[model samples]
Target: MNRIINPVIPGMAPDPSIIRVDEMYYIATSTFHWNPGIQLFQSRDLANWEQIGSALNKGEINLRGTNTPAGIWAPHLSYDAASQKYWLTFSHMVNMAGREFNADSYIMWAEDIRGPWSEPVYLTSIGFDPALYHDDDGKHYVAILEWETRTGYQAPGHIVIAELDMDTGKIIGAWHRVTKGFTTRGCAEAPQLYKRNGYYYLLLAAGGTGYAHGVEIGRSKHVFGPYEPHPSGEPIITSSPQHLFSLGDPDAGHFEMYNPNSIMQKAGHGSLVETHTGEWYIAHLMSRPLGDKLLNPLGRETSIQKMQWTEDGWLQMKDGSNVAKMETEGMAGLLGAGSVSHDVFDDFDQQKPRLHFMTPYREQQEEWVNTTERPGYLRIHGQNSLFSQVNPSIMATRATSFKYELKTHVQFHADHYSETAGMGLYYDSNNWLYVHLTYSERAERMILTVLQAKLGERMEYVHHQVPVPEQQADLKLVYNEGFADISYRFEEQMEWQVLLKAIDVSYLSDEGVNGEPGEIGGFTGLFNFIGSVDAHQHDSFADFKYYCVKNE
Candidate 1:
């Protein structure tokens, strides 16, 4: 048994879907507005996982301008035994205005793991968090959270199961609503199907995707049923379990519920898988609060808990507690897989850019991204400011730290007017900080500047213009545990002068960062963005020499 030493997939990698094919395990997470969407990970043992590539690279689905936390939702991965094809179903959440919660679901199929996947088939007009089950009768059924908006019906409605003809894109069966009572947690989503012994066990994610989130289990004697709740009378694993019938308890199933002793917080929404050796594991999305009550600074990440079957057939945590973090030793040998890998530190030595490059919005404009732009550098053109939610042409990776340094070098041959372009930190359309170089119109001197904006707020702060006698410079940002200090220097400067404004980086935390009221949460960490913004479009391009991040 191994407890997680470090959470591998951090930041906005929520609603995780995991499946083990043969000897290896693969996981896919929701990629909101980021292009080259659908992050895929591969691991040998359950403890470590590394990002491999995007499953939606073909520009398969459409997201007109869906920004953060809006593009791709919870993806359910499953393998069809009869067709021998791996299937992925997810919600392309298109709009969230007035909280109308507009979304359409689609399914993609692939035979090989590194897929030249099939075109996305428009599967349902239903709702998000869609899961697929290939029943023993060779029928394909889709389960989803039909998002509800009525005054009486609980939000996200109920978990509905229907037969979907993948070939014809139509529903064959009536929508069977499984759990409707408020205590099942009005938002029962992520319905998962498992066939064991003589029953169809459905594991569902209930409660809003918030502090109250947990996994619920119901079983039917048949594929479709008036399913009954598990016997223990509570969720199997959750942070807060129900003793009273209030909405505040963390959701869980009953058998061996709370460990009374574990350190992890609020764990639930688990997807289960059995290894080649017949032992079981649950790959679920859970979060770690930074201090106390801090929205996950890194957002919802994936964690695995070892599980085993009880004498009565209900799955129990290996330690026999409803808690989800206990380690189950010696399971790697059962899966015949190795261990998870390390973080990728790539500098693009190959012909094409490394797979980690992500453009916001669709991969539409080829002119914006090119690995061949330079020998060692990946070039992503900047079209607009940190202001526009659409077409930012920004490429970023997970911040992964409370204290870290990001630095980059750039050369700008701008027109007399197309003032600036350089590097910065990006958190969605609203928050950003860029260290750039621009020409001083009054002084006739080439100057360095820092332009930062708090939210999508229109007012920007341009730090005092300083002299940069040379053409190129290195811009650096030291994000200490809770504050950000930016500095820049010319070709051979010895000392770096800090800018006047030192932003309190803690404001970027889960609860502090500003977003739409109840609309966007701040667990998603910031990204280093090398940008080119020409408010006075006089230049053809701004060239970035290289971008690097490392600790002293």
Candidate 2:
């Protein structure tokens, strides 16, 4: 049997909610502040995955000026077999200041997954990570994290359930407070309902969103009554299986729970699916850091673990270990569909942008970004600066690997000092590294310069003037681990020369550029993009011949 790699869908795909429609498996993750909301992926054998399309593509919601880590939360995807429709439930987290945690949840449905998805119907403002469960008797239920605002309650609160009307989006009854959590790992959320052998199982993510993160489960005979924890009272799955004394601590980045022996960390928030062959597997959110560091540049990614039920009916890893693995055994006799292909090369010859391409906060403006104006080149008209959440003319793809080379060829004419176009690593509007071509007032010609943002502070450090007779330049960013080498050349015939070498960009990780003390940092990982800025005027645009990402 072939082994499946962990992080089946890599790079910022977190809070995964999965469902199997026939032989095909689909996973939808939180997009946070990024536009074209929920990043979605599809797979056949639960191993090789492909990013197919986004669910919130048509401005169904407004994310303008949304803060990092505070827009779209966990997206729950499910199919109602009776209605023959697909249902998606999500939360729009609008505020976290003072930990008020004000958020509104909504639900949408469609007959097909490649959706003409219905407009979002309001669910409730009770909490975040709302999910829908379609029961056997045709009753629909909603489960969510009930935010605890009172002083004496558990910091993040309990998992609550209530009956819901699928058509009208109305809660039929008052919220029933279920278990605070299955274990002592206090910060519980992401509750999903499932049934097996006359027992109703509630799977949840516990221990917060840091080192102690884990997947725990409970079961009950009744749908909304006293649920009992698994006999062990320990998590069914976790990256750090070792006992941690800080189980009830609400603080995140419980660095104390960091398992030195494990390669994967922060493994939790999982969704389970059963295969056609009767095998059980879970697609969960997991993270990998740079080395011994807790900083995750790729953010929380999706990983799979094969599991089996015990004679007692409780779920356990197939190998009988709670620890997460980097590789797991594939289903027996199941040769998966052909490996999903990633479009790493874009020659600007296609009529539409690739599915992998994404923009920050707002939808990509077709008026500013187009390939039709210049047949062989992608024309990106300059917009707001890269730091703006408004209209930044940046098109990007997730940095899937730590060691990779991103190259792009651009022809830019900057008449003023504020106009620039180039390629570099981006995390969000407030955090990024850009090596752009701009008119250097001192050099009297187009010059290459490096701009860096550390915790929202922007700084310009190194500069080099391009040699004369050079209009179009080939730019490359070589990232090996946490160190980045940014280089450029005037002509393709010329060798790549380093403009900035061995720059320690480890600060670009999730921990480095986080929000004010209590708020979570950017959960979305690093991206490589080619964009332009027009602080002087919107008349300037850069034409790119091609963009390529090669994993080293």
Candidate 3:
């Protein structure tokens, strides 16, 4: 039997919500602070997946000035068979200061998966990670974590369930306080409800979203009742199978809980789906650190595990092991299926940016980024600097692999020092490595140099500056295992000259950046971006002939 690789949908696709409708399967993941929020993917064979489109591409939400891990959180996707519509429920985390975790949840429906969705219906401000369950008797219920603020209460709060009026988007009844968490490991969030064989199952993401993360389960015969925990009293799925009982710990890092033997870390936050072949699988979020340094540069990724229900009516991994695996048994008939190609080569011939391209903290409006401005080229009018949280003119894509090559040809003319255009790697507003073309007043010429930001401190590599004879240049970045090499050439036929080699960029990872007091780091992954900055006049723009990313 063929094996399905871990991370079926890789690279920054976290908090997976999987479902099956007839033959096709769909998965939706979180896209915090990245515009066009709620990344959605479709799969045919479960082993292979493709990004179809995003749900919030039409300026339905504004994320300007959003913090690192604070925009759109765990998006729940469901299909209402009776209504013949696709529904999405998500949280807009506005504040994390003082651990208040202020968030507003909303629900929206679409006639088609990729379509004009209806206006958002305000749900509640109780907590984050809200999900909707459509019952058999035509009743709709919403399950969420009622965030706790009391000094001594169980931190991160209780998983509550209540009847929801879909038409008015209001809770018709009082909230039923469910279990804080099924397992000893606390920091539970992301409650997903399911019904199987007359039992309502409450699946939760426990042990925070870190090394000790896991998927815990509970069940009840009635929708609102005293639920019973799994018999094992432990998580059914986790990266680290070691016994860890941190009942009230609200910290999400759990760095000391990192499992040394497991290749996949932070394996939790699972969503279940049953295939057309009657097989069961769980799609969860996992991460891979950089060479045991415990720094996750790619952030949390989506992985699949084959699941089996035991004789006692409990869910577990197929092999009766709680440890998540990197490769698992695939479906018998759909073993060797074709997957979507990840290599991107965009020439900007179309009217809009490609579906995969996303901007930071703002929508990709045509006024700043457009293809019609120059035929066969993408014109990006300069706006704010990369450090600005609002209105930064950067078009980026997820860095799907540790070993990949990003290349682009740019035509930019900068007369002022603050005007620059280039391509490089980015994590957030505070961390990045940029190789840009800017004018040097001292040298009286256009030059290329390297700039880096680590924990919000700026550093410039002025020694590596190379004079560009023309206004356009070919740039390339080769990344391999936490290091990057920057190279450029003036013409297409010339050999690429190295500007910098073996730059240690491991600090760009999740655990490497500095964040809030109790948080681990930023919850976002790295992105390859081509952007322009004009702090001087905001009149300069960059024309890119092509953008390509190829993984080795």
Candidate 4:
């Protein structure tokens, strides 16, 4: 299945929440900054998932102030059979600023998938990854991993289940703390609750969300119970078929760290979905190491594998395999087609923005982004700088390829101030490189300048100017690996002149960028954007004639 089944959704699409409603399978993945947050993808055939929309597009939840590796966490998508409503539960990680671990869980229900969703109903305040359990008892329950803090003597955290009041959106009982130190890895999260035959099973992703991550299982006679970990004491599903670290970071799990003789690594934190075809598959997160050195700048993405519950009530992959590298026989031909999209191209005639987009603190306003400015072009108004968490005048799509070229044709008038708007690859506002068009003070014409920002340093990387005699110019960038060659031409120039040539872009990687300790930033891949800054009045409106990438 490894050869035929690759990650359908790539690039930081971790902590997948999947559910099958009728003939359709709807999936929601965690979005840190990418807006239209909680990207909703639907597929008739599991293999061909198309982004229907986002679960949280109303901007009811704000993630701008939410810190890196924080923001919107795991979102579980489910449908209530009794109520006939679609429900989604997710953590609004509000307080990463102090590492205070103050996050709030919210539940929203709608009659339709594309919905006028009900206002957020508060659920739990103690945990981050929250999943719902609906049993035959007609009772609703919520299971979560309550976080561990210094104030508590609980070591770190334990699994907690409580009677959930869906009507009032409250937990009716004390959080039942069960299954401690059960996972060989100290961290057990993304609990998936279910009941089969006579046992109530709780499957969890164990270890950290890293290389040694695995899937562990425990069950009880009751929802909250005297649960027992699997007797094997190792994850049922893991890439490295060894006693790897189930605890902290790789160094912490450092004891079990070794190069696995396989193509997939960091295969953990999965969600299970039972298909209408009566087959079971795991839509778990996995990473492909660029060089196997353990630095994953691309972040965890979703991969699928087939599994079955044993007679002992434990779910296992076919042939009792050690994370099968070959195709497993399960949902054969039950999948769908691969949606062929070029990594570089923005046709103004898309249903919504494609799967790769996000607004920082808020959702992109239709008022701000309108194609009505022109028939074949996109027009985005200028707002604040990209650095500010407030609404930035920017709309971007992800950089999906290892080797690709992104080009955009944007027309913007720069006024008295150094109002510049152009296109280039962006990670975060703190650290990014751009080739923007600005009005040169010395020269009367608008000139293209290389604005390379290195976070809060206030010093630009390569800020030389170029004269673009025309208002409209084509800005193109060729990112040969990390290093980039950015240039611009006004149809008058025969050749694409080199603007900022041969810049070592490895620093843009997670390990290279400037971030504090314990925080590896920007799991999301590179993105292309056209932005505007008017420190003065309203001086700029970026008219994007077209945005294309050399995805081939």
Of models 2 and 3, which has the larger lDDT? 3
Number of the candidate with higher TM-score, 1 or 2: 2
lDDT of 1 by residue, 292-371 (tens): 33445556677777788888877777887665553445465434344343232456566655565566664735586566
TM-score versus the correct structure, for each prediction: 0.89, 0.97, 0.98, 0.91
Candidate 3 lDDT score at position 431: 92
Ranking by lDDT: 3, 2, 4, 1
User: Candidate 1 vs candidate 3: which has greater TM-score?
Assistant: 3
Q: lDDT (CA) for every model shown?
A: 0.67, 0.86, 0.91, 0.70
Over the stretch 1-552, how does candidate 2's per-residue lDDT look in tens digits? 667788888888999998998889999999887868898788878889888888999988888787777899999999999999999999999988777888999999988888888999999999899989999999999999998888766768889999999979999979999888888877888899998999989999988788788999999998886899988887888998876544445547766788888889999998999987788999898988898877889888999999999999999998998888988888778775544544389998888777888888778767988889988889999989888877888899888777899999999999898999999998888889998888877778887788888777889874444643575789999998889998888876788888889988887777778654532366778888999999996899999999999886
Q: Which ten residues in a row have the lowest lDDT in candidate 1?
A: 249-258
lDDT of 4 by residue, 1-552 (tens): 312355666556777888888778888888876677787888776665676677778778776655455678889888889988998888887775444567899898889887877887888789788988777778888888787766534434778889888989888968988765455666777787878788888888776655566777888898888887877878777777677543433212331443467667767777778888788877777665555455554566777777887887787776677473423454655543435463646677663444455666557877777677566667777777766666677777655555677787778888754577887666666667777877777787787777666644444543477777777788888876567888777884567777777876545554445555544444554566776666567546778877777754
Q: Ten consecutive residues with minimal summed lDDT in candidate 2?
A: 462-471
- Badly placed stretches (over 4 Å) of model 1 are 1-3, 181-184, 242-266, 326-344, 416-419, 492-497, 500-502, 513-525
Ranking by TM-score: 3, 2, 4, 1
Question: CA shift at 17, candidate 1, in angstroms?
Answer: 0.7
Q: List the residue pairs that clash in candidate 4.
A: 1-326, 1-327, 34-358, 35-358, 148-156, 185-246, 251-254, 344-549
After superposition, the stretches of candidate 2 with alpha carbons farther than 4 Å from their true spots are 245-248, 336-343, 462-468, 515-520
Candidate 4's C-alpha runs over 4 A off are 1-4, 151-155, 245-260, 324-330, 333-344, 349-356, 458-464, 510-519
